[model samples]
Target chain A: MRPTPDPFTEALLARADDALVLGHRLSEWCGHAPTPEEDLALANLALDQIGLARALYAEVGAGSGRTEDELAYFRTDRDFRNCLLVEQPNGDFAHTIVRQFLYTAYADPFWRAAVGSADPALAAIAAKAELESAYHLRHASEWLIRLGDGTAESHARAQAALDALWPCTAELFEPEPKARLPDPVPLRAAWSATVDRVLARATLARPADGWAQTGGRRGRHTEAFGKMLAEMQSLARAHPGAVW
Target chain B: MSDDRRARAWAAAAAVVDPELPALTIADLGMLRDVTLAGDTIEVTITPSYTACPAMVVIGWEIEAALARAGLGPVRISTVLAPPWTSAWLSPEGRAKLAAAGIAPPPTAPADPGLFAVAAPACPRCASLATERISAFGATACKSLHRCLACREPFEAFKAHGDGSISNTASRDVLS
Candidate 1:
């Protein structure tokens, strides 16, 4: 019989899933970004996220002697614990930027706070990831300002994407039951302040909060998440135990 | 004989330069974390600067080759991710080497994305504070591109990591 995960392990698993899912999503744009430089930048971001996920998974599985691949590839969608925000469909360039901006806003402060985690491993990961995520936030913020204040069409699209994504932002602040993870309430305030400051500079309106979507923490993902996972895990599953 | 072999192995491994920087050796960069010897077998531990640094593969191979040249029977190069690497590890000589090669060393402070302006890196060429960041990323993963207004020359700055404070070398060099 399988043992129930303790609070720490569960929180770590959630962190890993969030990173792996979003990393895969970002990588889908590798050769497809509007500019060549952007392509490299997005890929770099994806690689950082994937690397973070690998480390988290390794730590989570160490006790069970399970490898990162086994946790990443063999797991079913039902087992994923990432928030719904990361798994939402990447709509357009504007949508992607908005999604990235909102997520990074949360991640930057979340990682900074995590640097003080009681768990040394988590603290170490946070120390490294905090730097990388800070860059991601800046990258996305610059794009937010550019798109929102650029052409009329760009401005309209940026606003539209913001409205579409605002609801998902709520999930980032929600915590798992009995989880020992750092409290995200302060993170939410920091994220909102950062987001508001950027939006003001970009001449964009802050969308009003609507009903916040939930359940991803409980592993209930959107329909798009399943397809994304299928593509991501296909190669690893096909070549079971393959090593370079 | 074993002591001779171990010393030779250390010398060889220390000589391998970082592939991306080329100007600095692994030892100079503080990347050669540790080397262990047990009879004829040796194990070397390396920590990569960035999570996605592609240079690690070449570095591992280079380490193997270096040890092999010393007539070491077999060697294992292990990459450790925890306790992650930091710019604070850059040696004083490594910092000089980077400056000489036209790459500004990271400031002692661990750079925060929110705090880029707090401790902007000086231009390695003219030692001018009048430098502006062109790109947060450069030709390599560990560097960011900056242009010096005084010299009208563009250069790369090694990113600062760990704690966001200037190291032994202060921003005073540029301000002066």
Candidate 2:
């Protein structure tokens, strides 16, 4: 017996929407990765993340009276609520790893909160996602350490990556209005502080000189987002009314 | 009767070897997940070993042909990724059949259930062999490459999705 679509439910649903947008951003890097093995690895991981996103959004879409495809592809840029870091391009191999490390560190705790959400559907999806996110964090963290400490040249590039990516990482911890959701996740409280701890171990310093980037949450997207949407939805847009 | 005839027809027609990993049939590998009969329509669910696996479209065509030949009105094939297919779903008999065919089976899950093994992959070529997994991303997402020192032959190892761990080891191309 699902409750009559409460505010907490909406928040969980919003969170899922946010994740789906970010997952779409990452999927663009599928075949372009530097190495074939890495290309497959990243693409495969992107599929898993997208798979997780689809589950979340489809469940939320069911609750919201919209189809998942409609929710994902039809929405205007301003309607998306994803984190800013994920929408950033895979600048280089190190840059991509930096983005994943920072994002999953935050998501690991976020999913843990969702796993125990009062809403059972949210909880079940979170439980499954928690395992996936845990692996993602492991993958990112290992890469973070490897890139951070690898060689002088690799270290310099990774540091530059850290500097470029750090600003957006800040937005991941900022609180959203959980008060309105049917089963609000206590995501921010538990997720933010620990990522700060993990960053220290990466031997990477938080950007001390840069201003933090924000706005994807409020649907204020960077210029890159519209391009992302254009390509991602191109097939559907081009093949309108076409069916199997 | 008719049901037996339909199943037999399907079983024969769909026993096509999966193009990506030829050791197993589309049916035995669980890629051909389900088949349902309606007088005017036949519906099938096919699972892809990997999400991006190229073999799916071919399998879909095969399913249509098999069902159409059996005189089922129309064939409908759908793909499901959820409860995403893992090697765990590989039937025990599928393993024995794989091994009997000389292809190494997937790594065994420990009975302990508590201590999840992360690094070990056994070599199928030599009985006393120590195996080294070369890469987490195999020929496809569903398989990994491993070599046994005892036999000096590199083999494909099925990846268990249940284990949420991925080892960042080296990558070796699987020749077979």
Candidate 3:
């Protein structure tokens, strides 16, 4: 049986998993994005997310005799703690933009607060991540606005994407009972304000918060997560000790 | 003796040029944080310009190689993230080198603008302030693509990487 992780480890893992999963999803658009500029932008964003995940995983792996690779590659779907929003597939450009915008809105403020964390290592990581998160938020917000206020077709697609992805965002603010880190609950107000301002400009309506999806924090994930994990872990599993 | 060794190690590490931006040394970019001789081991600390800067691995290896060549072995390289890196940390020399290499340097003034705030980067080719951003991202994470209206030349700008304040006291302390 696997040893139960402490609250700090669990919380840290959740953050890492969210970054890795979303990074991978963004990477899927590397060559497929609508424009050359967008292709490069998506890839750059993916790199930033993956970098954040690596740092967080390194922190989690400290003293555990497990490297970041071991932790990321060896973990199964049920053991992953990312929110449902990240593991969702890249349906279209509209879907990808909407997903990123929602996540970044939460992440920017979250990192800003985390910069003051009592944990020095975490604070350090948060300091670096905060700048990157700000860039991601700005990039996504612009795209969202353009899509929302563009032609009728683009507006419809952007709205549809936002509606589809809205439910998963609630899980991002769920309180971590055992964690001593910054509470995400308090960040919701700022997130809402940012979202509201962006949506107002985008001409997009905020979906009513109804049935919220949970369980990612508890290691339960959606179906798409399994397939994503399989692909992500395949190379490491294939070559147990491969080095570049 | 240890202080002398530490100085040598610091110089060796600082002299290492960034593989991506060869025109500037790591010191000019404000990436070399600290160097100390802990007993026989030399410890070096650095901060990446961006979280996922691809140049970091190369830079680390280059530091090791440079120190090794200088007989400053047993080096331990550590990365720090606090106070995060900003383009404001780029030395005046580094900015000049970047402009010479046909890339626009980031503005030195600290102005926190909104997401869609228009950045009017002066063109490196003709020194024209009438440049338009082609894209928010460029070939690397630390740059943005821009085109000059006067020169009709495309250039990359080392993006301003900060919240709203360009004057990073931590970086100033290090750079000074």
Candidate 4:
């Protein structure tokens, strides 16, 4: 029988999956971004996210003797624990930016509080992630404001993106029972403040909160996630232990 | 004999230059955190400047190779992330080397410019304060792209991370 993961491991895996999936999504835009500068920016964001994921996975694997690659490539979608928000496809530039803004808004505060975690290894990862997440938040927020406040078409797109992505965000704050790290529910206030301020500046209306999508934390994911995972894991699975 | 071995190991590791920023050694960039001799193994600890720095893998291999060439075998390299690396850790010599290489080194102690404040890094080419950031990110995760109004030249600036300071000014032109 598979042993049930402790709260800390569960929480850590959820965080890692969130970063890895999001990072992969961002990487899909590597050559496709509208501008050369933006291409570099998105790629850099992807790199940071992937890097954070790697570190978190390494931390989880430390005790289990599972390598980060094994943890990442070997896991099925049902075994993954990322929230629903990150698994959504990159709809458009606006959609991507809005999704990133929503996640980074929560992540920056989450990492900051996590810096004080009693677990030293987790704390170290948090410290590094906190710095990177701050930049990620800034980049996403800036693009979001520009898109939301720009010409009529851009503004409409931004608003649409916000409306679509907003519901998925509720899942990010669901309480992790017996979690040793800082509870994400408390971070919602700060995330809301950031979202509200940026939305106001961007002249976008806050989408009213309604029915929220859930279940990613328990290994349930959206339809798009399986396809993304299949692509990500294909190479690793095909070339098992293959090294250049 | 062990003391001599440890010193040799430290020297070898210290001499290794950052593969990305060739102007700076890992020592200069403060990437090398600690080196200790534990039994027959020499354990070296280092920190990454950014979580996703591509140079890290190369740096590890370089350190191992450097020690091996110095006759120090059984070396283990480990990375730490706590007390996260900041641009503030760049050594004075490293800063000079970076400046000499036409890249603006990060502000040693950045004044907490409130969020939305623009970064004004002096142009590495002309020492112009009249510089504006063009992009928040540059060739690497650790840099931002900037153009100097005085020299009309574009250059990369090492981003000042972890200081609660916003360095990217892509939305508004701060130069007026």
Top DockQ hit: 3
Per-residue CA lDDT of model 1 for A1-244, tens digit only, reads 4567776887889989999988999999988988866877788888888988987998889755678998899988889999898998878999999999999888877777777677878877887787677778878888898999899999999999999888888888876543435677777888888888899878999988879888888889889999999999999999999988
lDDT of 4 by residue, A1-244 (tens): 4456677888999999999999999999999999999999999999999999999898778756678898899899998999889989999999999999999989888887787778888888887887678777878887888898899999999999999988999998998763458776668987898898899988999999999999999999988999999999999999998776
Interface RMSD of 4: 5.9
The local lDDT score (0 to 100) that residue B140 gets in candidate 4 is: 79
Each prediction's RMSD to truth:
4.7, 7.0, 3.8, 3.8
Query: Candidate 2: misplaced stretches above 4 Å?
Result: A1-21, A28-31, A116-128, A174-201, A206-212, B1-22, B25-86, B97-104, B110-118, B147-153, B163-176
Error of 2 at A197 (Å): 6.3
The candidate with the higher DockQ, 1 or 3, is 3
**Clashes by residue pair, model 4:** none
Provide the lDDT at A179 for model 3.
48
Cα-based lDDT for every prediction: 0.81, 0.64, 0.86, 0.86
Ranking by DockQ: 3, 4, 1, 2
| Estimated TM-score for each candidate | 0.84, 0.72, 0.94, 0.94
lDDT of 3 by residue, B1-176 (tens): 88889899999998999888898999999999999777788999998888777888889999999999998789999888766787888999999999999989988864545767868789999999999988888888888899999989999998877743523422221100
Residue B73, model 4: lDDT of 79
Ranking by lDDT: 3, 4, 1, 2
Clashing residue pairs found in predicted model 2? A7-A180, A7-A181, A7-A182, A8-A181, A8-A182, A8-A183, A9-A182
What is the DockQ (computed on Cα atoms) for candidate 3?
0.48
Q: Model 3 captures what fraction of native contacts?
A: 0.72
What lDDT score is found at residue A202 in candidate 4?
88
